[model samples]
Target: MKRNNTFFRSVWFIAISGLGGFFLSLTGLSIGWMIGTFLAAALLSFLKPSLLRHDASKKGVPKYWLFIGQCILGIELGQKINLSFLHIFKEYWMTIILMLLLSIFFSLLSGFLLWKYSKTDMLTSFFGTAPGGLSAMPGIAEEVGANTAVVSIIQTMRVFLVILTIPIFVSLWASNPVNHVTLPAQTVSPFEFEKLLWTLVLIGIAYGGYLLGKYLKFPAPWLIGSMVAVAVVQSFGSLFMGHDMVSWWPHVVITLSQIFIAASIGSRFHKSMFIGLKQTLIVAFLSTIGLIFSMIMCAIFVSKVTGIALITAVLAFAPGGIAEMTTTSVVLNADSTFVIAVQVLRIIIVCVILPPFFRLLNYWEHKKHLSSHASA
Candidate 1:
């Protein structure tokens, strides 16, 4: 009976939060459902903590919901992978590398600012300011021994600011008004026996990949693993079939996935996160603004050098997540293929490089401390 009551209350809270998101989406906000729902849930968790509190025996939402969300997101991204798009980079390889380097440089600068000004540890600052996807960063932070809560909060704030500001900036600066962004039409396979078989096969592959990633200890293992599994299958299948594979997940399913992810992240925040973190929060906000500015400048440089439109370049260079940035590009009729490619490339590079770099930093810091102690 107690479990039933808790379930009902959670459903009510999520429903109200979804409604809030719906209203916000009506206001022309990009990714409003995610932002609105998250804010609504976080506010509730802050103002009426008792309403969201869970005993040791009962949890607010099942962990499997989040895993399902990650799988949905992975499959969505996998469906977007077009092997032919690799040809687009042939002529612009140099510019792409330069943009990626600039992205790393700006992230490092932001991390330094956070470390010095916010007094966050070096590892947390680096991971928090990393330009990787929000889905990946917090998990990576935990792996690197960073302060997960602070990293998650700061990374979330950075993404929220980028999504809120970039569209408005583009609308104001562009020759035409940037209207509300919408996802491009996707080709979806019909509900047939073959499609059902493929869906089950894909789910099995995702699960297998998740287990393998867990064994290998990959950051955001479920996410990256499922993405790789689906993408490889889709890519090879398309090569053999001589056509692109259609998306199997419907729109409603994707929306539900987003809601699950957003609500889970939001509910993790509590009022205590703010008790003694004023300076850190303020520094995070300012560093995020700085990071945005730096990326904008890099976008302009890429635009001038490569002859791509400013909007496309901005979306490509934006530190926002792949899903959000790609959606923005589609809505604005920007070069979405290029945007996704660059964003994915950047994420791969960051995830591969940052962890080792962080370990080196840790090693050096330890050595320096020991040297000082010996001198003393």
Candidate 2:
């Protein structure tokens, strides 16, 4: 069982690793499935050079992996969205706006302080502070002519921090808010001819779109490509067989996906990356707590207005996006829609408010540097 460090070896390693995780999860060994895949990758990395250099011009590892990952993710998410769900928004829009308004102010204010105190630039501050998609912020930062590189690093760092620490903290803090259920295994065989064919087609389109995006220099090629594919397919009524209540298999896929994704993300947490993790812990804790607490208030207010329970309203009020927050809400049997509304609203506010704030911060930074240089 000698494993070489070549790229082909890595592909075999990943496939074997994914299969191991998938089967382990299929048997209801939830924790093992997660740990096994991660350990597989980690052990493989011991054989890998610290850096596997690839030419950006020749299409690197990140592109291919992300293309595959995003396609799988799209199939999962695309199965959820339907035009029929849009009818509940006739009056809820105002409350949604209010939720977003508060989330924006609180999130930005939190970021501003951390930025100033951490002595990081404004773009880094904004991305670091962003409360939504870890994969989405860097692209937006680049688009608005902000500090993309620094912001990307900051965003990645924050995501890593949250993914590692938040679950541990929640396990301890909430203790028994709800029993966390283990995800189920895939019942529809991955090897089934129909499924395999569809998956390949989806993967093909995803990768094709991804290459096009890279050539076009889209800031987040995978995101752009996957989202485009998803939107187009859904609009054209090419939806997959819906799994509304989340069966064991998709649950298995998602759980395993998170582990793969998380482990891949967590591998970045070497000692070198955590120069200030201890100091940043307070900021992270406070920022999350404040944002969550604010959402709770919004939830309470909305609940009083709508006659839902405080807990459901609060769950809905929390500003985390549809994916993370909604899933948690569903597991807890709380108000997932309310949560979705609040998150969507908040993202809209950030998209609108951030460009101007980012520009202001950049201008201020440039002026400060010029003044210092003049004095020198």
Each model's lDDT comes to 0.74, 0.51
Candidate 1 similarity to native, TM-score = 0.82
- Residue 62 in candidate 2, Cα distance off native in Å: 4.7
**Candidate 1 off by > 4 Å:** 1-16, 47-62, 139-149, 168-193, 351-376
How does candidate 2 score on lDDT?
0.51
In terms of TM-score, the best-performing candidate is 1
In candidate 2 the C-alpha lDDT for residue 178 amounts to: 58
Kindly list the per-residue Cα lDDT of model 2 for residues 246-289, writing each as its tens digit. Answer: 21234545554444442343222233334554545466456656
Candidate 2 regions with alpha-carbon error over 4 angstroms? 1-6, 12-63, 119-121, 134-218, 232-260, 263-270, 306-309, 319-324, 337-376
TM-score, every prediction: 0.82, 0.62
lDDT of 1 by residue, 1-376 (tens): 9767766666676776677678777765545676677677667656654555464122345455567777776676665555654555666678888999998988989988888887688888889899976666665565566765687778879888998888777767678766554556545567777776777777787788788877887666666678777777877777788876554566677667667666655565655445567788899899899999989998988888779999999988889987778778777778888988888778767865776687788789889989999999
Question: Cα lDDT of model 1 overall?
Answer: 0.74
